[model samples]
Target: MLNLPKEKVIFAGYATFFMISLTKTTNNRLKDKLKTKSYTTRGG
Candidate 1:
C-alpha cells in the first residue's frame, strides 16, 4: 500500500468524481445536438 496523505486522497477522489460528471454532461450535450440535427434533417 502506497502511503498517500489523507487530504491528497480525498482531493483525488473529488477530482475523479468531478471529471466523470463533466464527461457525462459533455456526452449528453453532444448526443442532444446530434439528435436535434437528425430531427431537423428529417423535417420533424
Candidate 2:
C-alpha cells in the first residue's frame, strides 16, 4: 500500500471527480450541439 497524506488524498479525489464531471459536461454540450445541427439540417 502507498502511504499518502490525508490532505493530498482528499485533494486528489476532488480533482479526479472534478475532471470527470467537466468531461461529462463537455461531452453533453457537444452532443447537444450535434443534435441541434442535425435537426436544423433536416428541417431546412
lDDT (tens digit, per residue) of candidate 2 on 1-44:
45568778999999999999999999999999999999999999
Error of 2 at 30 (Å): 0.2
- Report model 2's TM-score to 2 decimal places: 0.89
Task: Flag regions of model 2 displaced more than 4 Å.
Answer: 1-4
Scored by CA lDDT, what does every candidate get? 0.94, 0.95
* Residue 42 lDDT (model 1): 100
TM-score of every candidate: 0.87, 0.89
lDDT of candidate 1 over 1-44, digit per residue (tens) = 35668778999999999999999999999999999999999996
TM-score computed on alpha carbons, candidate 1? 0.87
